[model samples]
Target: MKSEFQSHEPDEPFLSRVQRVLTDLSPAERRLGEFLLDFPGELGSYDAQELARLCDVSKATVSRFIRRIGFESYDKAKKAVRDERATGSRAFFAHAEPEANAAALALDMREEKDNLDRTFGKLNAGELDDLARAVLSSRKVWIAGQRISFSFAHYLFWQLTKIVPEVVVFPQGGETLGEHVARIQKGDLVIAIMLRRRVAGTKRLLDAILEAGAELALISDESMARHADARWHFHCHTHSDGPQFNHAAVLALCHQIVVRATLQSGREGRERLRAVDAVNEKLLQVEW
Candidate 1:
């Protein structure tokens, strides 16, 4: 009720405010607090009455919980949590693990299948072909992937090197991007695979690549909006049944890009493969 509302510290986030007094709550209030902890953004969408119903608490209990959490009013609490979630906090991904069971495994598979469907459902063959042609024509191909994105970038780099002759990635052992961005040339193609929890400087790096007159391919997740500066933007679906992101679609997309680039390469692709094979045979004398 409006009477429950009181002045609260404006700076504390709703999630933290709820957490601070969690230990002191009564059994019923504790239950409500625990529920909200899992879905911090829910406060922004659900009113006191709805929250009370969802938490199975009485209306009076909801009011008690709000004031206990230091919210001046429901509206103030809503704005606080909404703004925090909009900043892309990692707290949203935090959840207790589901038990390892057949049901969980099945859910994972279904989610992965959905990821693939959503990723490829709108792909354009003509657009893919055009992008592949750019890869084949570019003077050099540089890839930038940070955190978990680095693994996918490495995979794409390995595949592209089979036919593209030269492919480069970020330097090993924690080097900075400025050194690499300096190398991008007008005819170069930069494939930047930036996924969620991305580094702060990613957009600036992309901007620099564009300013250098280079072709930019940004393969990303829903967290990043499509930008016109990139020559092509491939948005991969990474949602999952578990806390971690499912990256099956990302691997599939990398494979597709390589396959299309190979087709675009034609004779050059075959010649390059043959040359790589010759070197491997001489050095290792056996294929793994």
Candidate 2:
């Protein structure tokens, strides 16, 4: 049986599905669905009565639309849209410093917590497990990131190395980027980390990896939906910080990926860790 999620393609004709599912809805619910389909971007600013007026329906009809779409009430529907907007806005402002006022700091903290909660709630266990398995099975894994994302790429490289010796972190910048990108081959997995204000270098690297026939996975903000052309993509919320730089949430996400990969890799993962331990001990003994 096809899951409801699987049955609904993102690019499907919107009106067809709306008409099919909302056929039994009262005139008001149909109006609300039509309004959403027609002006989705405007939903963030809509109140119950405002939405109803725009849809040529009563506020009560708008409320029914909420339940029809699986939400309990108009407020719940509105909150979902607001949360999505907040997540996108936060990503754009991530890296900015908190304001000096105590109230501002408190607000920032609240937003961050909400962002994290939303992010966690959206995680798909099945998708995560599949990603882990793919990484473990790949003959080689190349992690690429430029600028703010470089730290996340490096972190994944370090953790993955403990379990998968063939992992490589692309050099920050220089001819090495070109050389490493050229080396990507079939059966390799290229994990790219990119976010708001995407780096040109990262985009170029992703293109190269794609041209080389390597499987690609992307870690980025939800606002970057268009930029990510990977076979698999994960969005991690990093809002609530200042606009200059922020990678706390991204780092946490990378950690989860690595830890899950380790667990899924089974006995081979254990032996790989033991080998890494030996190498680390040897390096310590040889320190200058």
**Which 10 successive residues of model 1 have the least lDDT summed?**
93-102
Give me the candidate number with maximum lDDT: 1
Tens digit per residue, CA lDDT, model 2, 249-279: 6766788898899999899999988887788
Identify the leading candidate in terms of TM-score. 1
- Candidate 1, 131-215: lDDT as tens digits: 8998899999998898889999999888999998778987445798888888888999999999887888877888998988899
Task: Give the Å shift of residue 122 in candidate 2.
Answer: 1.7
Cα lDDT for residue 89, candidate 1: 66
**Candidate 1, position 70, lDDT:** 78
lDDT of 1: 0.81
For candidate 2, list the clashing residue pairs, or say none: 95-242, 95-245, 96-242, 96-243, 97-242
In angstroms, the error of model 1 at 22 is 5.9
lDDT of 2 at 167: 89
Task: Evaluate model 2: give its TM-score.
Answer: 0.60
TM-score of each: 0.76, 0.60
